[model samples]
Target: MSEHVLPQTELEAWGTDVQVVVCETCDWRFVLPAETSLPRCPHCFGTELELLSGEVSELPYVAPPEQAVPFAVSEAQLTGGIETFAKGIPLPPKDLNPAALRARLQAIYLPRWWVDAEVAALWQAEVGFDYEVVSHQERYSDTVGGWQARKVHEGRVRWEPRAGRLRRTYENVMAPALEAEKALRAQFGDYDVTRARPYHVDMVRRAPVRLPDRVPAVAWADAEMALRRRAGDECRQAAKGDHIREYRWQPAYPKRNWTLLLLPAYTTYYLDDEQRPQPVLIHGQTGRVIGMRKASLKRAQRIALILGLMALIIFVLSSISLLAVAVAPPLLVLGGIGLLVGMVLGLSALAPLIVVWRFNRPRRRPQER
Candidate 1:
């Protein structure tokens, strides 16, 4: 790997007295200020965040980001997204409302490996070019009242072996720096990287930048693969082919530089019925919200209790009415109706519990990477 130096001023902004902290539960690490007391991990909301005393140099890349996609989500968009998320839950916890979430929201930046490399490669692939074939078929047509010749067109590809030598510089190639990157994108969706602006010191000073957990040694392979795939596409385009396959490359990188590219996101959490924090992530660009909308068991149980009490009251009134039938014979019909209504009310007490149980039940589903 090629070495790159970070500016002295920017390095100070990252904090000279900074310490590395790793969440014991999620194993996600972040570089934070030395005096900053973090009660919870921003990524997973884990309470056990261990502060590492290792030197910054021990980590793979400590240099500040070269570019960043600034948070574009408006205040209105953020509130609207939270409202939509909350509405989906049947009985959300008290702290899960939009007002509470907005107040606790913290702006943070997630890391991605952005590498610039000069590549020289001997590449081979099968390039395919599209062509059209036309044939005439004899068909009986009701409109013509006689046999007619119809033309049929079919599209096909002709594959040919192609080999070439490429020497090019690819910059800002993206690769996952965190293990949870795939799962994060699957939930929050993609960012518009093209809109990234040059990074400034103020960006890090205001919000925490999650450091890359996957070192350059691991991410380099992914970066090289992306470069090779890009080269293959360009080669096919140069050959005037429609498709390419089985691309293989033997490459040498004369010079390469690895830097972090930060993407904007907001992290905030709401307490569930059990008082455990449930983390919520919002896309900084589009205000897309992704998190567990767990129904509150406490709230559900409260409703059930109220229903049970009402049923008991109805039964007591029915018994009194039934006793009154001795004094007036016409009161017998009212007593029967009261008993029936009490039974229905008693049965309805279980509705909230069943709804909450089904909503919060653990279902078999694909676990996000």
Candidate 2:
């Protein structure tokens, strides 16, 4: 929308602590106020619009992201991934193919926050130590000693005082900005956050950057809990004799480093035949793709029916073989027919699976009738 076209009153400015910009043209909003040098709106398709609400508001309620996993997966790899994912579902629609659907792939940076803190405390715990001891056993010797007893020896633990400090740069522990985080992970698998880098907006040039919605206080609390979990795990690993079950500590002089990080992803929306927006998510860094793809249930059912009919044929042939066995005692011919029919039914299963795989593949090309 042109600046001359937008309404005068600004809608409420919403989003995180960083820069904020409102589109005077369309109602669409964006983080990071528009640069004076840049003529068009970056977020809303570059509509020539005036900034209705250029007011900067403190994003105290949101946690800025710290770092991110750089893009490792390429477009080809993502396409292949999408193709593989489409193959597993049952009875899909016909219009869900890579060629038939419109897919737009743009990289997006998701928001996350990191916290660092220190803990100091007076703690008390008994650490375990293992020792071996022998006990005399008296037992009956096979034939010579009629009444003898046996003693057994065993190893046991001794309590000891243990103390330690834990520290680490916890990387890639994630928070989801996307509404479909679960479904995305289900499709692309898990991310290893150890490789994350500090957040930089320019790195994510093409797609939108999501800002955290969590307030600093709440995010800090969450980070503390996460840090404690990590510390507990370290304690258990360091235990020599047995696992560490419980812990008590007082944290002191806690200093925190807060960061805003971005995760990469590609998002595209397609208008199905019904004109509904069907969105797809791709792992921007790894190009691992996952989305809803369509397949023809009718086609699959037809193939399945053929296979089922072959199964029926196999059963019939087997029955005939049994009958022939009763009459002629030589039923090898009927048995061979049964085997052939069984093979045909087995071959019938491939069609549906193939149909599904094709359905999930990202449409590099548009679908045709």
Candidate 3:
């Protein structure tokens, strides 16, 4: 009966599944499905989160979700995140300010693939267990009879080849169910899905439900790999008292099904210098934002020049202190001044290096007219 209920439309733009969610302030529209209960947004999270027992709900799809990792980043975390993204730039577009970016940040419901699999796996690996002993020898000497002199310490690890049958049902190991998996991963890193919750749409509002560019079938290998990798790593952990050198897991995954899971992201865009669009992706799980930023080479140069001048001033001051030390013994003062000079030059060197690092980090993609 559940198999008959699973929605398997030929992978296309989720037109009917997505609704255009609009912003009241700017009237910007993001196509999102109408959800009843969902994870709280990192930027706009408030009450209705918890009391005594943690709430568990189901996503309105075929599969059941076992976990939902709520967004862990606080507002301060977001500020630091945006700052890191803006650190280095060559003449950043005038509009690239945190205030502007924060004002435009939109909460998005990125799709996650929920996988239900009855995995029967046979795995082989080298297991290692460790032991250590402090060994001391009783050596009697003529002068000091029966005296404890030196203690020897050595470590030992017991390793052996092991094979086992691992049969387990992974309730909902999230596979990348979205078609836009690459773009999303490029924008935001992997989420901690152990904290995933059953999909409820009510707590969150603005959902930039960009339909998955990848179909479920296209992502099956990825799905299997995710589960297999997890199973192997965890099973190896169960081997207990041994370090796993190498492992191979051949799992027979039968009755694999899907669920529509949602994740959190703060998406915003800032126009670059060339009037091109630059998208910002914030991790709904961690509040880590990844996006391209333009740095001001001129600003870097100006800052460097000022620092160089400061270095020169410190050098002169150190020399002056040394010369004047005849009256006051400026060894400490002059050394302090020299240290200050070195710090200035070091800072000057770092400014341009930071600028170069940022400029090369993300390549600017020109928008086609």
**Candidates arranged by lDDT, highest first:** 1, 3, 2
Clashes of each: 0, 34, 28
Residue 11, model 1: lDDT of 44
lDDT of candidate 3 over 79-179, digit per residue (tens): 88877676555657667778877877766666666778788888998888888889887777877756665788898888888889988888766667554
- The model with the greater TM-score, 1 or 2, is 1
* Model 1 ranges off by over 4 Å: 1-16, 48-50, 53-60, 136-150, 316-327, 357-369
Residue-level lDDT of model 2, residues 241-357, one tens digit each, is 464445665555345555555667665544444544455666666666555555555667677777778787787877778677767776867677787777777677677867756
lDDT of 1: 0.81
* Model 2 clash number: 34
Please state the error at residue 241 of candidate 1 in Å.
1.0
Model 1, poorest ten-residue lDDT window? 1-10
When summed lDDT is taken over every stretch of 10 residues in candidate 3, the lowest stretch is: 49-58
lDDT of 1 by residue, 244-341 (tens): 99988899999988767889998888898888888888888989888887788899899989988998898888889889998988778888888888
**TM-score for every candidate vs. truth?**
0.85, 0.53, 0.55
Q: Is candidate 2 or candidate 3 better by TM-score?
A: 3
What's model 3's overall lDDT?
0.60
Best by lDDT: 1
